[model samples]
Target: MPIITVTNHVGPTYALEPRAPTAASATLFRNFIQWNVVNAVDGYVVQHIQRNEKYWVQRHFPRHQTYQAVSVDDYWECWRVTVAAGVTTITPARDLINDKFTVVTVMDAPGADGTVGRFPDKTGTRGRWKLRGLVYFVADPGLVIADWPAGGAPSAGLLHSRLLPPIQGNGLARNRQGRLGGVLFRREFAGSWDWTTEDQRIAPRADDGVGAPPLVTYRDPVVSARNFPALAGFRSRNIRTADEAAGGWLPIARRPAHG
Candidate 1:
């Protein structure tokens, strides 16, 4: 079974109020920020994966195969969040954790038709092959921002954006047509944040700008392995025979009984 791994490279840059008493305190505060950022990004990525799975099952998989139910084992797929090594310093203005980094999310869905098994069932002697598709979303830079409170943790709403709707039509339809289908991939800061009062407050925006109020942003564009040049390669893979697809299933062993 092929594992679906989505790697997200979030802010190597983070913004926080410079109010910690000790260096350890500052590191702890930064860790809190890192945890929240990782959670928010992970939530978005999971939603996208679920949306893609639903679309694929409906459009690509055979009619008999239903959407695979998620199990506990599936949750074991490792989710590793690492912060880049950087010096934590306070300079009367604000503290920043500025090290470019990536977070990886792995989804292992064994026995799932669209994710693990062959797409179309073999017909008579005809061979079948397992196929998968990927797509990328490059959100506009400097769109995601977070407002941290001076005395308390930031509100979850401050980091979350509106859920992105699933792309409609057949499998890989958007990629095939070379468009986003009008679905915007950005944080809902305008709708989610209180701009009237919080606009002037200290906040971090996702970007590489320096000397400006610190912000957290995804420096890399969201990309799928099955897009453009790679899309052609994905579509032209050689087919596998039924014997090869059977994998390691063995016949049931039985003991003969005396009459």
Candidate 2:
């Protein structure tokens, strides 16, 4: 399985206007100074990227004679972690903030005990950070529907049977708003579903779209059973929580807190 690695680029722009009466000062104030800073910060820090970037700008470029205002922008680069050998090495890369930083090596194979390794890296003398590998178990649609009986009919001694199809698709694992935010995976269906009494029928009609259920998962359950006459044995599963419906992601490494 290939893991996707994301590199966050934080660029800070310092707007300047001359407060001095010198030609050099006027020239320096005419244009803004921008720096391309990159951080391998994990999902946690990336979640507050804007705030972090503002803090960086404030700390690095304080109020000066020529300083007017400061702004920051974030960009991302993603690549698949692939290695022909058992391990792959990432050489030292330079950014404006950190002169030169080295990315940790990634292993292609799992440990002898069949467990993935946690490779940690420390940049600067401030704090220590660790990178943990993540693997997503995508459900097979065929395998999921295979056990489901044809025609949505309940087996012997069974009152009702509902088919829940696998919602994971080949798209990026994005949110319902279609924003990746800090996530690097593919998109998925994050829509809500309304399971009514009609959906709970013992034998759903062939034209009810029950045979080929919708490709949805982690959907919010809106049960309107009270509106319709309820069956004695028909019971609906508990509604999924927000966190349960919204999947999670682990970043490469979190930014160390400033001392």
Per-residue lDDT over 1-259 for candidate 2, one digit per residue giving the tens place of the 0 to 100 score: 2233333343111122233543222110011111221232112111111100000101111221111111111111221211234443221223412111111111111122322223221111111111111112211121222332332321101211122322323122233422223333321111111211132324434676624333222222231111212232111112222211111111123222222
Return the clash pairs for model 2, or none.
Answer: 42-253, 171-186, 171-187, 172-186, 172-187, 173-185, 173-186, 173-187
lDDT by residue for model 1 over 168-212, one digit each (tens)?
A: 231123334322233222211000001012222344454634334
Evaluate residue 52 in candidate 2 and report its C-alpha lDDT on the 0 to 100 scale. Answer: 7
Q: Name the lDDT of candidate 1.
A: 0.20
How high is each candidate's TM-score?
0.18, 0.17
Candidate 2 versus the native: TM-score?
0.17
Prediction 1 TM-score vs. true? 0.18
